[model samples]
Target: MFQESGVMNSEVVGKRRKAELVFQFRSSLYFVTGNLSVNKDMTEENTLV
Candidate 1:
């Protein structure tokens, strides 16, 4: 019983870590795209001025 529970706990931990990594990667990707768009807007405004 103890061994079974330990195995289950490890599986859960591994899944949680994988989920955390995916979330971090997605958020960083979003942030990079957002910054790129903002920079483009700034350049357009400067050109207009």
Candidate 2:
């Protein structure tokens, strides 16, 4: 029935939201790691100087 379909739709939306959140989390981690590596290189150069 219509009510069942509505419930199913909301469940699908929830799953989609979760997937989006996971994607965002992965991208954030990647960005942070990238920044950390760059900072490490800078720190090393500073130490040498």
Candidate 3:
């Protein structure tokens, strides 16, 4: 039925949106972690001298 198809489509769209949001969150986390690590490394080098 047409109604069933519409429901299925909406569900697919919702899933896609959720996946996109999760991916964005994960990417931001990776960026933050990398930045923190770089800063730590720089600080350690400065202290060594």
Candidate 4:
């Protein structure tokens, strides 16, 4: 029973870690994309002028 509980705890920890990594990755992607979009807009406006 103790071994089973330990395994369960480890599994939960692993899942949480995976979720945190995914969240961080997604947030980074969002910011990078936002920056790129803004940059593109600026470049386009400059070209138009």
Candidate 5:
């Protein structure tokens, strides 16, 4: 029973870590895209001027 529980705990931990990594990756991608959009808008405005 103890060994089973230990294995389960490690599985849970691995799943949690993967979820966290994916979340971080998604957030960073969003941030990069947001910055790119902002910069693109600025460039467009400058061209118009």
Candidate 6:
């Protein structure tokens, strides 16, 4: 029983870690795209001027 519980705990931890990593990756991707759009807008304004 003890060994079974330990395995289950590790599984839970692994899933949680995976979820956190996915969340971090998505947020970073969003940030990068946001920055790119902002930079594009700034360049367009500069060209207009």
lDDT tens string, model 2, 1-49?
9999999999999999999999999999999999999999999999999
**Candidate 6 per-residue lDDT over residues 1-49, each given as its tens digit:** 9999999999999999999999999999999999999999999999999
In the range 1-49, model 1's lDDT, one tens digit per residue, is: 9999999999999999999999999999999999999999999999999
For each of the candidates, give the backbone clash count: 0, 0, 0, 0, 0, 0
The candidate with the higher TM-score, 3 or 4, is 3
Off by over 4 Å in 3: none
TM-score of 1: 0.90
**Candidate 2 structure, TM-score to reference:** 0.88
Residue 29 displacement in candidate 5 (angstroms): 0.4
Q: Estimated TM-score per prediction?
A: 0.90, 0.88, 0.90, 0.88, 0.92, 0.97
Q: Over 4 Å off in model 2, which ranges?
A: none
Please identify model 1 stretches exceeding 4 Å from their true place.
Answer: none
Estimate the lDDT of model 1: 1.00
lDDT of each: 1.00, 1.00, 1.00, 1.00, 1.00, 1.00
Off by over 4 Å in 4: none
- lDDT by residue for model 3 over 1-49, one digit each (tens)? 9999999999999999999999999999999999999999999999998
Query: RMSD (Cα, Å) of candidate 5?
Result: 0.7
Highest TM-score: which candidate?
A: 6
Q: Which pairs of residues collide in model 6?
A: none
Task: Tell me the alpha-carbon RMSD of every candidate.
Answer: 0.8, 0.9, 0.8, 0.9, 0.7, 0.4
Clashing pairs in 4: none
TM-score of 6: 0.97
lDDT of 3 at 43: 98
Instruction: Give the Å shift of residue 14 in candidate 2.
Output: 0.5
